[model samples]
Target chain A: MKKLKRSARLVEMTQFLLARPHQLIPLTTFAQRYGAAKSSISEDLAIIKEVFEDEGTGELQTLAGAAGGVKYIPKMGREQALHFIEQLCEKLAEPNRILPGGYLYMSDLLGLPGLMNEAGKLFATAFAGRDIDCVMTVETKGIPLAYATGAELNLPVVLVRRDHQVTEGSAVSINYVSGSHKSLHTMSLSRRALKEKSKVLIVDDFMKAGGTIQGMVDLLAEFNAVVAGVGVLVESGEVETEQRLLRDYVSLATLRAVDAKGKEISVEPGNYFSRK
Target chain B: MKKLKRSARLVEMTQFLLARPHQLIPLTTFAQRYGAAKSSISEDLAIIKEVFEDEGTGELQTLAGAAGGVKYIPKMGREQALHFIEQLCEKLAEPNRILPGGYLYMSDLLGLPGLMNEAGKLFATAFAGRDIDCVMTVETKGIPLAYATGAELNLPVVLVRRDHQVTEGSAVSINYVSGSHKSLHTMSLSRRALKEKSKVLIVDDFMKAGGTIQGMVDLLAEFNAVVAGVGVLVESGEVETEQRLLRDYVSLATLRAVDAKGKEISVEPGNYFSRK
Candidate 1:
């Protein structure tokens, strides 16, 4: 394997840890893999730690004693976790989401945490070993899922605002089309929110046209940062374009919406978490 | 110290882990203090682990190695930590917070996260060993501070909404009159959100008339929960009545409203987070 630069190693580290939460890896392992000193690795961890805390997703822990290593645990409470899964079951039972025409009401599912937190966990689990700095999500509905994912990883969540707020000041803006709306929408990030070359896990509530996802990909590039991973809360199982994005794309819930008389539907877990 | 009940011990354990994170404790010691079996202590730790994971605070980690036991790390990242404080400072600095003469405008500062998070951490650091299950705040503005406090402890945030939302279902409401407002403002909590006998830490952005804090106390009575501690982001240094209600209070910044000339003001850290 080719040696990765410090920034690239940082992205890889974040992605690795996010993938397998609650499993600790010794600092020496990362140092060995990156061909960097343990102290340098520690410094990188500190930067990742700062950004994650700022964003509020998953957290990094320095374990003590021999055999101690870092681990990432998805932050899902007893009530909140049960509430989410129950809601998923309830939402899946809804006929509108299971249209006989094989179309799902994913917009509704995308906004629900019952399904979203799973996606967040799976994504975090997938990148558990890679150095992921922060989880980035675009504005509006994506915020909740983003927050949940960030919380699990003990990382801070940096929101990509669609419009500039006076409080956020001048922002770095990008343009993309809505898959559902097909109309163009702009996504922006506060210049102060994300630093150059930070490793980011890109997540969204749902992926339809994926224009927004593509826009985010471009935005990360503009900042000279790498896109460590891309995951979604919901994905339309039948979409061809979403399939072409990557061979390894993951989704929490796949809806095969069937629209007929009264509508019918089926729901299943996505491959993101299962891959691990 | 009096031997606390198993439930209280659990709450205390959770609260302790929530604060002074990343410090380890032996199972034998914890069991000895609580007068419970080692197995029971293990089970209590499990419950706390589940709770913290669910609430998104940090994590309760147990090590089985020869030198290992359990430790809590305030898992949320440094940015998450500092961002909240900066927010409070900025909000407290607002001009309207300036009172008549030399007094600072503080209404906005009362519920801000930057201040609240700092105050919350200060309290969390001090009461790291007490039994605190929830962080309670009165309606509207107080919610932010409450959420900040809850975040530090990895406790679930339950807001006392001012108006009932269909989303929250039926709620228990209370009325209060503060020095700032005479008309009774109502605070409500969904009956389903809080549990009876919970050890709660009552927190608010500001305490002026003491009416809002009193109303929160009354609401706690309705739930049969215990008040573990009380923390305020900023306290009116001039108020004697509000000062009397504090068991433990943390003030990131204090203000004494000035007269017309704006010449005199007093500010300092509250006793809550001071190193003994």
Candidate 2:
């Protein structure tokens, strides 16, 4: 923690804020870190703040009073987000991505850190000011997206397993029919994984009929948790148009139509922006 | 992008390097972005690079020549890595984490963005000069860890599935006994997941008797790929002492023994440092 010049300090501070988004860092902390006065730290933050907004990196919110400081809220520009989602739609429309049951193969996209981090930032932006305690998702594919959003929000991620694992200790398990398959599947969460009455934001890689989301909502009820928001990377508009399971959720992309036999499909940006 | 003051340019430059680790960013890009002379960008990078190294944030390698530029390699300082690993060992030793059959509950740990990022940086540091093409891991539990490391290394992640799915098109699957259970498990990588003769880094959440890691190594052989390195977050030392399937690997935490009946466990830092 040696003293750094103004240029070096600004560089380090930018990285510091970027690394711990949505968490407040008091001016005093930065002041102490650099052995500078509060006024100087404030000036440094001002420069960092302007550049962040200009580049659509995120937002820098400053609080007042004794506990006042700065908080970095990760945000993706609307145009950039739309562009990324449109690219995602193109990937989904690929013939090879079609599965046996009309599902899209997108685990590769979900597994990319850069893509997940971008999507996570968008989710964080959408759910900002909800006073979210943590982000939640089912195990497997959704875990990366959930973690990415949690990182952006500086919140923890809670995972609900497809099957109860002994390692998780005693847990709560609920059976619900999957949206696409209609087959009953059980999802469980450890008692310690989530606290009672917590405000949670749920995220997933894809949603078919919203059955999985509904199941999560039902499971949240058992712990007296509030579902502050639900976000999905892709939603099956085809299934929802026929029979919807849940409403009032945000989707970044929508699967408009699918032709499994001909391997023809169409995808478009979801209700994420339209809802706003 | 509008040209900015020296202060603003430094902030944007730092973020750009951080976002795309390991990719050589030409000096011309930054110079043009800011409309600044190459000399000024070099000066700004000097300040940023010094702070990055001083904070143990990462390494900034500046390459010379027509196609060369600067590359950011994510790295965690040794002290910080050790501290993080110690914290992990403590979390692992918690009584409630002990599950049936001596498995430790760690999905929560893997789900933490901050923790995973740190572990990813350490892994990136361990395999710094291996010329890795991608980070690889099996589906489900190991996805998050693999993605984390891939992010730090700025490489794509290749996922091996427990069961082959039609959506993946053609796949190469191999059955191998899990180290701890000795149960035969089939792991498959999509034909498109990796390239022939590519250098791969294999990562996992937990390793017991090194069976899963060995499975991945053998699986890589199917693609005619080379195993550049292997890393795990936690390893079962007791089981490994009894029978180890692989000897060359890096682990962050070592679960020495687990007393399921007594709910007491002995844990320590892994051979990560000793491997050096």
Candidate 3:
């Protein structure tokens, strides 16, 4: 790469850092890439760090040492996250979202990339500084949220399949009760998909009794992996406290009520805010 | 927001543009956000544009007139994309990726956010300037790829479910023959999931006889939608020409052979390069 002006270097540096989150990059690499001095690179980073902080995008952590460089920690400020979730609740509360059998139609909301990206940032903010190795979610709806969170955290995502596929050879399968009906269901994960003793973060789109999440946890036990954390986009408030299979988890929104016949629905910010 | 220094503004402007790809943002928005003059915002965008172009990250397209604004079109250069696809081919060629039925284990690679992000950029580049309304893919493996492509394209993703879930109110289901065994399988899409006559871009993880992709195309016909394009991560070379269901599609890599017993595999750059 040829030498670039300070303005060009600054723009390039910002783009580079934004693309890579949670990974440390040495100043020398930037200096060399821009054909600038280490001092210039550090000065450029300082400017980026301030803007990132002021704008509530995230933090630019600099480590001081021979082997240290800088790391970008993607996050959404508490106030901004709250505002976003409030808007999400408003959207989720739309009467049209109520489907048959008291189910809510959230696939449309989940389809938005911008919305998913924001939700991912919130989850990353909530789970920041945790020793998590990877993000795990069961198909077929939770995959997008899991990938979004994985992107923000700079971690790989592992998907738990609802049915075993020949493509995922030699899988460990587990059965658990799910939904309001307490119907038995089977979920599996490929043996090669996860490493033993991995600190995994479980993510999902929705949780009722948390039986599905419990199934994932139980499946993880077969692989000797530890559950680092659990995050869900929505949780059923209708579930009785005693009926809930999981105790500790994070949710962005809580589905309060759904009146299918009357076309009424209610949604509120999840326990994420109160948990803090 | 308060006024910011030139350096801080530059970093913020870069981050802003990077996040909202393919969406036009008026200069006035930046001006108001930074409490800066339109001239200053223009200058900042110019610098960011130059760096983005020079780095081959993407292009910052500026429109003229009252409604005009700047839009970020994320792209990967042909040479850079080829280099990436070559690396992907090498990774796919690993003998250990071979499964019992000669299926390659690509879940780990697909799970990588960085890789998916890059692949998304490549697909976005390939399909740049197309009249794409939404990105569509089947569950459960292709969701991430579709979301990745959707994020890059700044569009929504519609998932075609393998089985109809009650949560998806009313849906249109289609039956198609898939795999070497030619077994019939069902796929469904929620009626509310897609708008009528939408121009959709289909994406997937792999294609053998193109049966699954064809199934998605056939299902799209139910909604009177137009197939704008199809993109796949890998295609099988073993599928005979006459037996292949689809012809027009883009792929990153091609699986030439997989010897599960001998632990041998062969992979190469797909028709994406040849099509170009």
Each candidate's DockQ: 0.06, 0.67, 0.88
Candidate 1: fnat, from 0 to 1?
0.00
The sequence of per-residue lDDT tens digits that candidate 1 reaches over residues A212-274 is 788888888888888877777666665676444444456666655444565555556555445
Predicted structure with the largest lDDT when compared to the true one: 3
Q: Write the per-residue lDDT of candidate 2 for residues B28-142, one digit (tens) a residue.
A: 9998889999999999989998999999999999999899799998888888888888898989898888777877778678768888888888899899888889999886677
- In model 3, how large is the Cα lDDT of residue A96? 89
Instruction: Provide the lowest-lDDT 10-residue window in model 1 chain B.
Output: B107-116
List the candidate numbers ranked by DockQ, top first: 3, 2, 1
Cα error, candidate 1, residue B260 (Å): 24
**CAPRI band for model 1:** incorrect
lDDT of 3 at A152: 97
List model 3 lDDT by residue over B72-189, tens digit each.
9999987899899999999999888887767788889989988988988889999998999999999878888899999999999998998899989899999999955699999999
Query: Which wins on lDDT, candidate 1 or candidate 2?
Result: 2
Per residue, candidate 3 scores C-alpha lDDT tens digits across A85-155 of 99999999999887777888999999998899899999999998899999999988888899899999999
Chain A superposition TM-score, candidate 1: 0.63
TM-score of each: 0.46, 0.96, 0.98
Rank order by lDDT, top first? 3, 2, 1
Pairwise TM-score winner, candidates 2 and 3? 3
